[model samples]
Target: MATPPKPTKRRTYDAAFRAEALRLASESRSTQAAARALNINVKLLYKWQKAVQTPVAAALGASLDPTTAAELRQLRATNRRQAQELEILKKAIAIFSKTDEQ
Candidate 1:
């Protein structure tokens, strides 16, 4: 029998490296300059900046400061709770549908 091919490995970055990248992106330096100084690609830095900025931009109309880390955490928590509620509703609907079919 032929052996199966090995799975490709995914690249994993260290937490410290990620933290440093975020720190550099958060600084006042230009994305290109920060990426060059951090030895990462400028495109990646731009991507990170977009990902961080987009949410804050969306949240800008809110009274709370979107740039604050605490606001981000609270938003994340609210999202998590809504997701959990959605999952519970899905399971309940499935159970009820099965019961109805019985």
Candidate 2:
């Protein structure tokens, strides 16, 4: 007797996750690379990109001026660098303290 085929489950993402995924896609070199990193289909990422290109979504993004966007990008880069430095300092402290205990 032939076995029954299993039903496929569709995964649904929330608005926040969708927004983050879109942002990641824009920052990545290619949509396909971003989709692969996020474990999602490239077509789906393209769909989201199309949706965001609509008038309503475009208007929302238009609220930020080019200068403001550039400033925000710089600030985010600095913040990321500082966060990494903080993590390295924390690890160094742990190692130094461990050695002092000997």
Candidate 3:
């Protein structure tokens, strides 16, 4: 019986290089042609394209969908505004307290 082949380890790519690969794959005449020109696997090019096109907040490392991400952004904005208002109210209370002691 033939021995089983060893599984290959996954490769890691940097953001800039991955972006370029995706762009080349998308803008090229064909994925096969782009892969050939880049000397990369055609399936790897497709994978890179999907990663680049995914709506992910990479900085936050969050992989939420676009609508969810937009909602989270709006919620954060609202939270910030509310926090500011609360701080102002606390300051006003302190001012009023000082006047009461006068």
Instruction: Identify the leading candidate in terms of TM-score.
Output: 2
TM-score of each: 0.40, 0.53, 0.41
Residue 16 error for model 1, in Å?
2.9
Better of 1 and 3 by TM-score: 3
State the lDDT of candidate 3 residue by residue for 1-102, as single tens digits.
998999999777788877677667656778899889978788888776556542545555546765875687578669989999999999999999999999
What is the C-alpha local distance difference test score of candidate 3?
0.75
| N/CA/C clash count, model 3 | 0
Quote the positional error of residue 55 for candidate 1 in Å. 2.9
Model 2, span 1-102: residue lDDT tens: 999999999999999989889889877888999999999999999999888674654666768766876676678779989999999999999999999999
Tell me the number of clashing residue pairs for each predicted model. 0, 0, 0
After TM-score superposition, the amount by which residue 86's alpha carbon in candidate 1 deviates from its true location, in angstroms, is 23
As a whole number from 0 to 100, the lDDT of residue 21 in candidate 3 is 74
Compare candidates 1 and 2 on TM-score and give the better one.
2
Error of 2 at 27 (Å): 1.0
